[model samples]
Target: MDDRSEGVIEPLPIRRLQESLINRIAAGEIIHRPASALKELLENCLDAGATSIRVTVKDGGLKLLQIQDNGCGIRRADLPILAERFTTSKLSTFSDLTRITTYGFRGEALASMSHVAHLSVVTKTKTETCAWKAHYLDGVLVAPKPGQTVEPKPCAGNDGTTIIIEDLFYNTPTRLSALRSPSEEYARILDVITKYAVHNPKVAFAGSPLPDLSTSSSSETSHAIRLLYGHSIAKDLLHSTFSSKKQDEAMEEESEVDDRESWKAEAHFTNANYQSKKMIFLLFINHRLVESSRMKRALEAVYSGVLPKGASPFIYLSLQINPRDVDVNVHPTKKEVHFLNEDGITDQISDTLQQALASQSHSRVFEYQTLLTGGIAEPEQSISKKRKGKERARDGDEDEDMENAETKTAASPPLKKTASQYKVRTSLQDRTLESMFPVINPTQIEGSSSGKGKPADISKSREIKESECYLTSVKTLRQNAIKGKHKQLTEILEKHTFVGIVDLNKCLSLIQHSTKLYLVNHGALAEELFYQLGLRQFGCFSRMKLQPPPPLRTLIEIAVELEETTAESGLTKPQIVDRIVETLVARREMLSEYFSFNITPTGLLESLPLLLRDYTPNLDKLPGLLMRLGPQVDWNSEKECFETFLRELAYFYVPGPLCSANPETEDQEAQDKAEKWQIQHVVFPALRRYVVAPKTLLDRDVVQIASLPDLYKVFERC
Candidate 1:
């Protein structure tokens, strides 16, 4: 053996880490960057019920980071141990963790910041006459100067909280070195504030030298998007709400104790026409901003087929799930979260987004294209040439005018040299194209006529029989089942007598039947009725004829414009538009007979479905309807296509709120009351007689008065 090997190896002694060193190690996990520290401070401000939050930064927060909020401030007595680990007002016992609804818990954020940076707080609660200020370091209150006391001192301030952090990650050279430039860090800070502003639009946010962000207390999500993201995004955004309920009654009954299993997801996403180089994803779970790579990837996959290569979309999704179903403690910083039914929820959200995108894309109006007079000849000429060439090749058939051109020119008088004489005319073999595009008179030719051809009649009506109307698909079956479950409500509706209108604003009505008083949701009843009416009158819907019907070319042009805006590779924009126009033109007979769309071959909309005699279908949305017909309707299977078409028709016929430009005015109010009376006497009774009632109205009991007993009991106590 070597002499060095002969020496005995000594065991190293075990020792506890110094308090400062231990704190620094913990700080590394929580305060990874200046943005991370700022996020924690912002969360604290929000938890204090701050309505206004102000942030200040210097050198990308590496030198200075400060946040002030006008909210209920911290108690002076709590300052001493405010930075202590695991000290929090949000939770007390272990069981309280499961029901935590606030953002900042564990009380580790401030403690971690104190260890890595200089931390100070100035706060004044409503009860306090003066503010109390304190400095902290390593989880303990510290003196600001050499001779100052190590305790909170009374100071002048507003009734809110202000937290200041300086020299973030000062104790960790490696972490400090890992950070990017100050401007980059500030960018990150702005991004966090932007997302939070979107989530809590009621709260105002300001950072000096940067534009202030604020919204009305009652502002919607779209308002926030317009204020923060810009009008471009707001204009193109499509919104939807999704919910999941237990399909099996047994499963629902077994989980009655924790009935919070249901979840709702809301999404605001850009359409296919709106594209970016990279996807912008904002995800909030239970109002907490979090990152889920799995969800991001799933959503991104949905847009892959819709967008061109390297193009992406902006998506903002907020999910309200039960606290018990989410694991918010997976990371120290809580930047990433894990949740139950991740894959299933992700798929549902993705599918919903895809459908919304398709619908939105099909509804876009391309304002640039001229409907009839301009650029219309190119597509028609191309189609006519192809048809003519094919017909001649197959049967040597030619138009009468073409075959007798010499004889007609020799026999006919000299044509008038007017501007109209130079106008070009197009001819088709049958009424399909003629209905979409009509032709003007021309010189008659006798011998050149093709005996095999029939005269094109654009005004002829085609009828769809009742047997052709009752088409059902899997989706239709499921919908019917859901509607059928409300048998008890349907019976009640059949027997009920319309009493009067209770709340016009809420569409609530009062009805009496079988010696019982009941409150009804007239809006829900109207929807159910409209759907049933659509099924019963599927093939021969009443028609609302438009006077001087709008040009069909206008609708086709709008569809073409939408397709061009959302153009992709492999198919040119014009080609896509042509395909859509062709499909709609081909289905003209089916559309007219079943949906009451009497469109002329020369691009004229003759009529539409008249669900209500006084209510006219919004013509502005007609282009969108025509555009969607080519994509959303299933043409491969007649049953599926008809089912989808009827569903869309029913949705279109659902009653809309009466228009009130100045609802606050007395005249408007009076008008609204009159309208309500009309609906109560005329609409409600009609609906009750014909429409089926849904089992649940707004997720409440539809027919049964279970809550009525509780009301009576409360009245007795009163």
Candidate 2:
């Protein structure tokens, strides 16, 4: 070598790192500390389908960390290469990487730990007569003591696996030095366990500090959140489930979509009522605890409009995406992750939380105070100070001391304020869509016609059959509705103050919620509302009994005449009628029992399912519904049959567009007004009661027309 000490650059001889050194470096990347190692072990336990897990730690797991799980155990034959790198049962070929479902696939977790610490495993498969215990070091099996055989030894154990790690980072002093203190490490380990417990609430988790850390198996996610986060958060929690519309369409079309782009998410977040100094966010992508600052920041911004400045909300979100769209191999620890459509997904979730918060904010609690007698009241200066203190709180300087100061001020002479000063009243005439495009007032037409009986009787009639409630296909459809609900529109419909009909011809109406106005397409929303209701009340329908059963053949003939008048079909009129009559007569029992469509044995139409009260399916369209029930419904498959049948029923129930008949004509005017009244009183109320407003209706059915705040800004500029 040249004289390198003389300030002249010189190259040193190249040499490969020792195999042990190489392994130690790689191990450092995987197992940063005790917490990282515990995460890997926990994932392995969950992957094995363990329902109960017990974790033990000593000296914050630097000295010892043990995890025992009652899951499928490794076979004795596979013990020889248990710690070998690149050996795994989860994956086989390179292509398998695209669809890895299990927690461990690289086969490096155990090997990495072996290089940095003492690793031992005691595993017993159900078929095995005895358990096998093995010790590993540097990715190879090793003897327990000097002169002993370097092979696994049969031992007494339970029917699961138990892994023990000792002296973590023993061979890597640099990695060991980078670790936190024992107490801090223990806290980190506890946090990891806590989040995993929340995600997999059905799995029992038992960890040390027994009284402080233990969770029993639970089925309800809300119940689990209550147990872990406390009563405050749980009480204020709002739940929502959502998925890609592509997935919904795929189920209907029975066609494959790009799997890499499909995803679903479930979120439990605190409403405006619950607030904290810092956000407590737990995100699980594909059930693996991961972090995304972009998502966390986006969610935080959503709460800014609802919560006072400097306050945060608690959120727990679990996301499931196609494995092909995710690159879990990007990081050794797998804590930080990225996925396709992240921005879109984040925006959707944020919008959902924003609406939930907005709706909750509408219900305000009023505080009443009595002033002193004889005109004695709080000093003006005191009132001024109190107002300034609230201003600070609103400005984000909310602290305990300030709260205490405010409390102290409250003890002084109380201030008496009028309820009008506190009430949030809107001058409707000043800025309302109804004022611009006026039609019959929604409130004036309320109870204009004797609609169907009370909702209580309707609910009683819609009793679900216990047998049908548990059907897999029906549950999936119901879940799709829940997962596809659009939160903002749902809030609008649920709490909106009905404005008035905007255009009877277009079938559009206006409704106000808080300070914003929305134009709702009553026709489209009613169709979607009925569709969701069909799925929601599957196998349980209240019948709308016809006075006398009409002959099926007669209705079919009527439908044939109508079809011939409307447009040409693939089949002739007579052929279409025969097909529809034969199909209905074949499935009469199914129709009568599940859908409440009681058909007589003589092939005559009878009662129909009462989907919505106070609203009737126009008999004009009944023939069409009856005619298409044969060709449109997929009678071959149970799921498809129910889906297509419900769709046809929903379409039939949606009223036709408003009549172009002259408004001056008495009969036509009465019909148009009756339809408008039904929209406001029957359709909208039913929507508030049952419809979750799925994403399909977001822009198409409901559109925001004007906002009160925006109007004020415009006025100010003028």
Candidate 3:
């Protein structure tokens, strides 16, 4: 052929396609596979106000798919044209589309099914005495058998409707071939039903071929989630509900009519504790399941800050907007939809859910634990080397250091602390405070001259001696604490999320419990913890031996010198010193036997009782503690003496103000950081596990700062 002949193409005359072929092509656009057909039928059942739905599938719905619902049945006259396109009871005029709320408005579901598959319907209204059954092929009623009349036949049935589709995609072989295996198709069917079940928890649903796919009516969203998903996902789930409403610019113009721009959203999402490799997202607009890649990406971005890398969260979000504001006819299968204020709505929802997840104690605790455990364990030498490198990088900029630390934590997997790991154990057998917050490097230690002493051997393997005496006085003190414990405060401490220190000089820290934020005076809380430990341990206190024990008289002299500057007393400093030394020495045997306060025969203060593991009391406060024991105690009464003495010891062990008040120098800043690390890691974690916060702490130590609901109300008014 010549080049001119090849380039000269003739246009064919246009002609209308055959009606049968035209209907078949339109049907293929709506019903792509077995799952698509099932989706349409399920929606039709729901639109009819069906509360209970039962489904049966064969060969993944390729061979047969049946659905029975106890809904308002069809009329006898409507059966003739029920499978015809555009014959729907849901709409009448063009304006009806604006306010359409029903799932099926196009009325193409049954008609589409008829063109590609064998379709039939069985129905009976409440007013009718019996049910009627009809069969259809290619959008028209057909005879059930050869030479039979082409009309509905009366049958026995309940007051409902049943739809059955046979040999789906039999005529459209290409669509059928594009589908997955039977098991895979079945899995997709189950997934669709599960999401609908969670959204419409009040409606009952049953799927045959497996018992696990059934859900009962009158259930809650949380229960449905727990039933369909595993308990692991349910336990770590977070829920949030948000809405948007435009306020009238003029009060005089405001009417009683509802706002057309208003929209509401409800969501159930997993927290940081629950993570998977792939995201499980279910989005429904106006109760119709749909997909929006923009919305999905927005949600995934919200969890990125909380969950580790390569992990995602499970989210179920349902949005209800004014029908006039949403365009439901954007997709042939109604799977993808568009609405007004789509970007604004997505942002509002993402923010609300992000706030909810951030407030979860589980997520906060998980992050805290990750930082403490360094995510996964490693050799001691390796950890030290890595920490050294980080220290150099974190030297001058405190905020940058925190940012880097959080980035590392966000990249690491969550560590689970189960119930078995927190079982109450003997002090000697328990994990030490130092393990959670390791001691600072030698350079930092050398920079501080205040409160300096040899840190205790806090290793888990360290051996120490403890008192074994069990006395009645100690038992009474323990019983009093148990009787006076506060129920609400106990729960709060047990599940609190540790926020960082608010005022390091005041020993004040922030913590979140449930949706409430609280300011905790950890210094005061620590005193209670140590006091309780002393009571419980009674004679079981671990001993902290003092090297080259100081003489009792010498300790008294130091106390006298410190007291001279602040005390206004009748007795002189020398007189006060002599009295305290004599009183303590006289009661040496009693102190050693029950309180683990060892005093040598030569009037030397040998050792002190260790109340908390790996926690050493400030040696600087020892003189003040010894001085207080003499004057504060009623030595004559057995109960009074033990109570006052233990109180003094607990007071001494409570951490004092940070040494570097200004933090102007490098050494001072390092000291502040080290102090903060110990309080956040060692002290707060111990309180979470062991202490039972009493009601007294509410007024004196734990102060409620804010609550989630209250904050929302304030913002709404603004």
Candidate 4:
């Protein structure tokens, strides 16, 4: 037809003739890009509980985006009209949208997709003897392709549906042009998959070049991540457990008691260690694939007192609240949602996350000692696997160079002491992250919310409510606080989001430092546990006999005052000793700080009986014994232990507990306490020094030093 004859006579847009074409145009409106389209289909498959998902993408779904599922398949009779607009089997009436829990609703995803893309529905009903194949164009049943007509053919297949979207946006060039590169597009896909993969651990997801797949995506993803890590992410890993019950309780408590709860709530407590992103999977209850600004801000606030100022986390939160809780009709592409309990949900989530995170215990085991010599290998296994894999075979010098370049970036790993830990996260991870999950990157807190210098103060951080996950009971919460006053885990105990475990080698790669244990949280785990346990519940009080040491006293003073103490009292030797003792006794965590220490989910603990075996009712009692025992004594009573600790603090002021002890001990208190502070602040890099570098952890004295730079060549060569 001539241009003049076409519906577009100049100004007004050209309108399609048939209703099917009209429906197809509408379909395009719903299914905007490859990622958006994939989101809808994936939702459906997930709702069906398919354990394994295989996603094949070409040109980011422009050429073809195929997803096959093993869920209950579709009926043959419905195949012809499946592509039609406003048709769905998930719900029969309009009321369903109010409680639409499934991923697909509005009956528009398939219909809208059919409009602009070549659609194929190959489905086999669970009861059907064979699968039926049908094709559609412009939301209407038609030949599979042009000029091809064959009745829906029977094919052998398992129970499920495979949806193929071909020539996406074939009708709209402008939209397609806005898409990113293949790697970038795939990144978005990976983003989508990652959110789903972690959210539903029961389900496995993988994506590889079509017809060129070998290993599992999780394995491949883990390895590729290793290549990008430049430095190991974690070491000293332990098992973890996550229960939605805690999340739900938190949700309910917020909605009811705190009045911050939402129309619906879901909590998740995972028993597995996560890599460094502080991973979170967020799925808003009422909306699909979107983020509310308020929600983000709310999340930030909840984590504010808990996480450091700049640090954030990788969270995959799936919220299932009343539809009225959120307005999904806000965005054209549905990337944003309006939440009802925006503040409530965010607070609940952040608080819950804080608690979940605070429960982290790092005493994870590695190097299994079996009668037959068997245990889960170290994370370096991933590094070694890289050398033996196809990546080593196919991606030669050029790829290595590119990776080296990526490593040099802010995210890359750098050279450090052999006994030190890596920097945790680098830019290499940032670049490779998208390849693993293309749509959205995982949450990262390093340099983001790391609570750099004194975040307000412990008092201010304590001002917020303690999350449920970290609390054993209200009384226990109170007891925990009392316990923490003796030690100083206030900074680490309050957040919920522990990074994954790492081995000594991996630990050295991630951080350039020596730390028997360390934690980076906005709040302290000891303090958080205090609130969770509700110390009031535990009437038994083993009061802190020790005072803060000099250096620790200064830090605590700064935290409390946000200013340096200029008073002569702060400079007094006796006062300095008091502060250090109190801080150490109170803040120690039994679980390993190194991420590689693997421990049982429940067995992982912050306190060990051995560490708490000694105490003293009176500080004077320790000195009498020091006179008899030559000052340095490992007391055995719970009460005497506390006193012995206090005596150390007294040393901070006057050098006496060690006066009768070793000749080098008098001045060591100040230096050691100062060093510990440096490690605590993350200001000093950690370093471990061994005599002769044994192949594994078993070979070293494993002295926890303050900084990597402190590692002597003797230590390094060891």
Off by over 4 Å in 3: 1-4, 246-258, 361-718
Candidate 2: which pairs clash?
none
Off by over 4 Å in 1: 1-11, 212-218, 246-260, 362-718
Residues 1-718, candidate 1: write the lDDT tens digits.
6655989766789999998888888888898888888888888888888766778888988998999887789998899999888889998877776767888778899999999889999999978999999999999999999998998999987668999999887777888888899889888888888888888876667664243343433356777887677644776788898878656889878865344567889999988777789888999998888999999999999988888889888899999888878777788998877778889889998998988877766543433211110111122233345544544454444444445674555668864221211233222222221134343442222212245433222112222222343445534644663556556566667666565666666666666544345666676576566656566566667888888888766776675675433332234656656766777778889888777878778667788776543333335556666665665555756765775566556555544343335677765655554455445444565555565655434232133232222333345456
Name the TM-score of candidate 4: 0.43
**TM agreement with the true structure for every prediction:** 0.50, 0.50, 0.51, 0.43
lDDT of each: 0.68, 0.75, 0.77, 0.45
Write the residue-wise lDDT of candidate 4 on 325-433 in tens digits: 4556566556676656466556656666656555664332233121211112223234435334533454467666866675366766664222122122222123221
Q: Which ten residues in a row have the lowest lDDT in candidate 1?
A: 368-377
| Residues 1-718, model 2: lDDT tens digits | 5566777976789999998888877887888889889999999999887877889899999999999886788988888888888889988898887777777788889999999899999998877898999999999999999999989999887667999999998877877898889999998898888888889987778765432455655346887777666555786899988776554765859866566688888999998777899899999998989999999999999988777889999999999999988877777788877678889988988887787778776653332221111111223344456555544455444454545576555458864332211223444234444346565533333344235421222223333332358878888777777887767667767766667787877778877666566777787788887887777667788888887888988987976785432222234677767867887988999988778887788987779998876677667677778876875565756876787789889988886542266778766666776676577567776776677776655534566666543454356456
TM-score of 3: 0.51
The true-versus-predicted C-alpha distance at residue 334 of model 3, in Å, is 0.8
lDDT of 3 by residue, 201-297 (tens): 8677876654457665557999899778855578788888777853465742675435677898889899878888999999999999999999999
Error of 3 at 493 (Å): 38
- lDDT ranking, best first: 3, 2, 1, 4
Report the C-alpha displacement of residue 10, candidate 3, in angstroms: 1.2
RMSD score of candidate 4 (Å): 26.8
